[model samples]
Target: MSGTLNQILNGHLSLYGDLPPIPIGAYDSGLNKTQRQFRRANKISLLEHLATEGWDHFRRQESVATGLDRYHPTKLPTINPGVLTSKYLLLVIDGTTHRAQSLAVTGGWEHVVSCSLANMNSLPNLLRDYSAEWISICHASDILANGALHALAGHLQQAKTNTVMTCDDIIVRQLWNDGLGYEHRQYRSSVSAIRLCTRGGIGGLLTLDYSLFKQCSFAPSYTCLEALRLDVLLQITREPIKTTHCHQALVKHQGSKNPSMPEQGWPRERCPFSDKQLDEIDRIKSQHAKQYFGIEGGLKPNPLQAGCHDLSRPTDESSLVSILIPFRDQVELTSTCVKSIQQNAGKSCNYEIILIDNGSADNSTIEWIKKAIKEDNIQCIRLDEEFNYSRLNNRARQLCKGDFLLFLNNDIEFVSESILDVLLDPFAHPKTVAVGSRLNYPDGSIQHQGVVIIPGERRCVLEPGKHLKEQEVIA
Candidate 1:
């Protein structure tokens, strides 16, 4: 069963060259072909017919219901605005907020209401394959633990070109910088000014703020160049949030080669702040306490005074250091890491272990720390939720008392405390935003020297490794 998928994706090995091929289609059987193909060709198709009758499973998760079933194709309606007035297309985003999706373009903001349906069929080549975090974007709904709408919003805003041939030799250049979707983003960032000039003059003007729009909301449910400006009062939540709903919950997934079937007779009216229907939300926001304290009034202690690069704190070259380990759910490795830290240290520096029990699912680690907390300051910050590496580390950083902030992964353990003397000494020189320690596995081999994001991979690669050091050795 898995072999069939391997052949399908491995055929794309020509695309990656020296880099290994990835199994993107392994988990996507329901999206393309299921094992039922040998017996019933139309089995998957029959499922789609029943799905539309009454089903909320595929509401945000878009995929051809019949693709795996093979019995029926999803029924989608095509209505040209030139043909109908009230007959409008509606799209609903999974309630997650992607900053790019919810951008309400104000000045010179002309909205596009149609998608380049033809260009959308182009797949990866449509935008010249600029490779813009596309690996993450293509499977964003899946890569993310939460909603994919927020990620979709960012993709639509980031796309530079999306054009298709039109009647009478016309070239339709879609100009939708601001759009509303499952995600949210500001238009003013990338393009400086993002507003369409005119598209057959049927849409809103380019010089108006669509949020103030009481009449026409954005149009075209999903596209790089189109966004419907539906008037609502509720503002889209910009904080990248997640829902407990697992990816397995989605009946199907949309992919680069494997596209999602559009749900017909569906409407996308609900969004955070799209002239939302909420009457008292404004009052509720005003009444919320955080906005007034840290937000409206500015920092309590001028952050500049506290200083990010303060040299006056400790010049001992080796003092009490604060090590922050932000982690969640990896009991085996985490236990090994904790013990390593407890045991090793080439230097005797006063240091406190800030194990940010970053929403760990394993209560055993939390329990062990609590027993030890009888003496040390193990501030157990229960997130009450899940993991978001950036947010968790930043929160832990604020509580750190050490003169330096050292973020270590829970999977790692310090092999050299003398390395800290070197690590902190460079910070003393004052220009380093971050200084990394030389890390290694028990095999006496280098695990990491520093970290840098290798573009197109979407994950950070260890800068110093076997291959990298070999190049240096050869040089």
Candidate 2:
């Protein structure tokens, strides 16, 4: 590993050099911080070389190519290369204004059919006419990303029964909400299908087993019929279907020309819902949660309009949470954090703040800690050893006396009164391992919304949408 890295660092060798290609195990097995640094530095060049000449070289032989090349150009010459032999069918729904021909169908589809609010009932009938094993549906206005159809076809190979696969979209133009720009909306795996079903449809670019359509009874009046109807159908049925949002950006939304178009209910570009619609949406959301997740009242009362479920154990009412704060000697920051918790803890449940002091030497901080311990009724533990963050939290975890644990930093200050409840709501589900909150800087800029992984020659972590305004939500 060192030798290969040195060659790249010193510009002494190419990927075609005497050494074999860097094995995937080389990343995991042998590498110190310096060795890893060298690999990270040269990742871009290595990836670019692999994509062009190296990939072409391997693909020409076909036998020597890695498993990663299955979706490459050499493998799938066209979207539906073997439509006659393949069991999958790509069905494009030609909307009222945008017909199938206007769409970027370069990837290709098996068939295109006209659809409207009047003829929405004909969907099941149209689906029944197809003899394909798996059926993919998309709107005519929605452009297919390069290799999207082939990717969907590839996905169906191992897809389970009742699994509806939706892909991330690149929003080309959205005139609604006074917004017009390009944005890639990537779905989070942790987000529940129930949360999306009532809010909005996933999108038109989705594929499922042909038979799964039979399980849903469509209402003729539903405007956003393509993907929304299918999603709602899966939710209403007694049997549950897993909603898998593909990580690949497989669809491109051409954007809605008008804001008020009922048929074009794309995720971020939808018009405002009427009071009646909101009521109906809320009722459906509550019903789904009560039926599926066994939440007592459907949605937990949260400041965030998209209410979450309280899936904690039924018998254990009012869960006691232990808030763990680890700090070294920033007395001012620590004081503010404690004050915020005291003021905005809300009425969710009882909680105890366990402040772990990691060898604070400042006289003011030590004095404040002593006063806080006696007056604030908060527990304080002193670790006189070297500052080890993980060790400090682990030590505090041992003394926590709550049903759930919240590891908070001393630099954090709550802006929302319901922050604690919002954080605890997801814990209602017993299988939940952990929940993360969107953090913002003091200046109202995002500190962290979520962590995303960037896969390359070497995998790396990215804090995407890190510095965006607090108002802008990432999908």
Using TM-score as the measure, the top candidate is: 2
Q: What shift in Å separates residue 243 of candidate 2 from its native position after superposition?
A: 6.7
Candidate 2 segments exceeding 4 Å error? 1-80, 89-115, 118-128, 143-151, 158-162, 168-204, 226-254, 257-286, 295-317, 361-363, 375-377, 428-430, 450-464, 473-475
Tens-digit lDDT string for candidate 1 (194-261)? 00110010111111222222222222232311122211111111121111111111112222212221
lDDT of 1 at 96: 28
**Per-residue lDDT for 45-154 in model 2, tens only?**
43454445444544453322232222122111234443433465665554642465344255555454455544567777766666767666666666666556676667
Q: Scored by Cα lDDT, where does model 2 land? A: 0.53
In model 2, the number of clashes is 3
Worst lDDT window (10 residues) for model 1?
190-199
Can you tell me which runs of candidate 1 are displaced by over 4 Å? 1-318, 346-348, 361-363, 375-377, 441-447, 451-472
Per-residue lDDT for 428 in model 1?
31
TM-score of each: 0.30, 0.62
